[model samples]
Target: MAISYSGYLNLPHGFRSHDILAFHDRDSEQTAERVNYSKNLLEKGILWQGMPACLILQFKKKQQVAITLLAEGGKDVSELEILPIVQRMLGLNQDIDDFEKAHYRHPQLGTLVKKQAGLRVPLSSTPFEALAWAITGQQISLAAAISIRRKLIKALGITHSCGLYCHPNAEVITQLGQDKLHQVGYSKTKAKTLFNLSRGVIENTLPLDDWLTQQTPVEEISKKLIEVPGIGPWTISYGLLRGYSWLNGSLHGDAGVRRGLQKLLGLESKVTAEEAEKWLAPFTPWRALVAAHLWMSL
Candidate 1:
């Protein structure tokens, strides 16, 4: 049996739902089962509290301003749970006034922000899901990583009649061995990391779910995440920005980000991680948005 609900949500100022959905268009890291942006609607499937869920969203405006979300054909989710999950997945709950204020002073970031206002950090459905994506994308191009993850989801995720899928939970991933994972496009080292992360979370060794409500520092969480095999600084920083909305961090080692920075800063040579850090310093607390906009500038 499936449970569902539909309701209006308050959207943040300048929020363009399609532009946010476009972020999902390029990445295959299985951020959602299916994410489609059209002229009138945004449709997606996500695992909500470990259950497969599909949502059809539309913005409504008049005397009352709101966005509509219709949750359909999923198990074990209440209406209350759906909205918050959607909010987190789409970054509807984030207030970017501070980010805008902080970035307004930076010469390049100010123009970037103006060109791409209300572009949220585009969070994953949960911290665990976010970490899974980071693990899959290590040492590869974003498109290739996403392709491998898509294969993983096709092999293990739940599906709908319309052919959309829902990403599996850690419990499900833990059951698959290295052979199965490798068949689904994971390299040996990446496969090991996936198994370790899934089993660690399942056995309470990772305790990623604890960060959902518990007030934990981002660096503390990163420290724990990188302790897992094959995890590294780039994953830690990217996960902080995408999974937990920790915006103060920079995308120091990302090749694409470095290229974007070098071009935006008018540099002839490549921007090293150290140089990226120095350039990112003035942006300070707004690096998250800067990175997001920088990627767009590319």
Candidate 2:
């Protein structure tokens, strides 16, 4: 039997529900997240606190949203547990007022912010998910990364009762050997890194979930993550931005970010990573948010 719980959540100011819902539009396969545009709904499969389930979010009138949790085999989840996960995934508490006020009048970012206001850094369902995605995206183009991610999900993701695949958890990934991962589109080095990460999680050495619970400083967490092989600054920055909402992770190494900066500055030549980092230095403490704005500008 299936079980469900329903509740209404108040939308935060600057919550661009439509834009957030549209995030899954480009997914070549429905592995985890799905959106029903005409119904203003998004369905995502998640493994929360050892329970695999599906969450359905319905955008409604009056700036409030309704959420339903569907769990197979009658597993139950309380409102307290469900609400926080929903809040985090939706980025409800990620306030950008200070960022907007500080940069609303800047020479370059100001216009982008005005045009793309309320853009919060949306997170993966869990820190592990973010880490895996970052590893998958290393040194790859966006289209290629997405294709590889789809393959990984299809190969290892858990299938929910609704037929939607939940992104593979660390334990699940560990079940596959490097050969299998390679066949699923992961490069040999990336496959090795994935094993290291999964083993770290299983051995409790990484303690990602603990860091989130304790609200550990981003620097502290980054230091630990950087020690892992194949985990570089770009991966750490992107993962921290998406997983922990650490807004200052310099994304200057990202091709899209650099391209966005080039376009924003009206530069005729491609911007070097060093140059991009220097240019983005002024937007300290919210560099990731600024990067998001730049991406939206593209």
Candidate 3:
């Protein structure tokens, strides 16, 4: 029998369900599993430490959000565990003031921020998932990357409701060979890197969860992530931007980000790496938000 459970999360002011949904809705990947919109509410399925559940989150009123967690067998998860999961996934606790300061420096940012208020950098429900996404998306366009991700999920992910699938966990990755992933649209190198990453995690060589929970600085985390094969500075920055909401993170070498930066700065041509850094340096501690604003502008 299907089991049902529900929960509530109190959100701070400026939290908007629409903003969160928009983030998911804009994903260039397969739609149904990424998020579902129905009956005036949005639903997303997530795995909490390998436990599958569907979360319904939406703003109900001032300082309040309505949340419901549905899982088979009514599996019990403590409030402490569930709350942080909701907060981090939806970025309910991320402060936008860091981004707001950028608007103060650049008036154009004011309009973008106002238009996209309550916009938070959405994150993977799990840290390893974040790492996996970063690795999977490398060297591909957003649509192509997400398409590959969807195929990977369907091939290996834990089954969920409505014909959706959760992102495959590291353990599942271990069970699959490189050929298995390549058939699902991964390049040979991506497949190998992911296989190695899964092994690294299982072997405790890659402690992603520790980085998330502990007080390691973003720089330190970036340093550690880059040491892994197929993970680079851009991936580290992208991960930090999504998971940590690190304001100083830059999508320095990202093609889209470079284009956005060029357009934002009124440059006639694309910028070199050093030029990008030089231009973005003035927005320290908010460079990531600046990137967000540039994306919004485009």
* Candidate No. with top lDDT: 2
lDDT per model vs. reference: 0.72, 0.84, 0.71
Predicted structure 1, TM vs. truth: 0.88
Q: How many backbone collisions does model 3 have? A: 0
Predicted candidate 3 versus true structure: per-residue lDDT over 7-49, tens digit per residue: 6777777665665676666455543345445533656666644
Residue runs of model 3 more than 4 Å from their true location after superposition:
1-5, 26-40, 61-63, 107-111, 114-118
lDDT of 2 at 36: 89
Clash pairs, model 2 backbone = none
Worst 10 residues of 1 by lDDT: 62-71
Q: TM-score of every model?
A: 0.88, 0.96, 0.87
Best by TM-score: 2
lDDT of 1 by residue, 1-298 (tens): 2435656777765676666566666654434534444444555666555556666566544311233333344444455766766677677656577787766666776777777777787787677778888888887888788888888887885764344676677888888777899899999998898898888889987787677667588867878888888988878888777777777777877887788888888889999989888887777776766777788778
Q: State which candidate, 1 or 2, has the greater TM-score.
A: 2
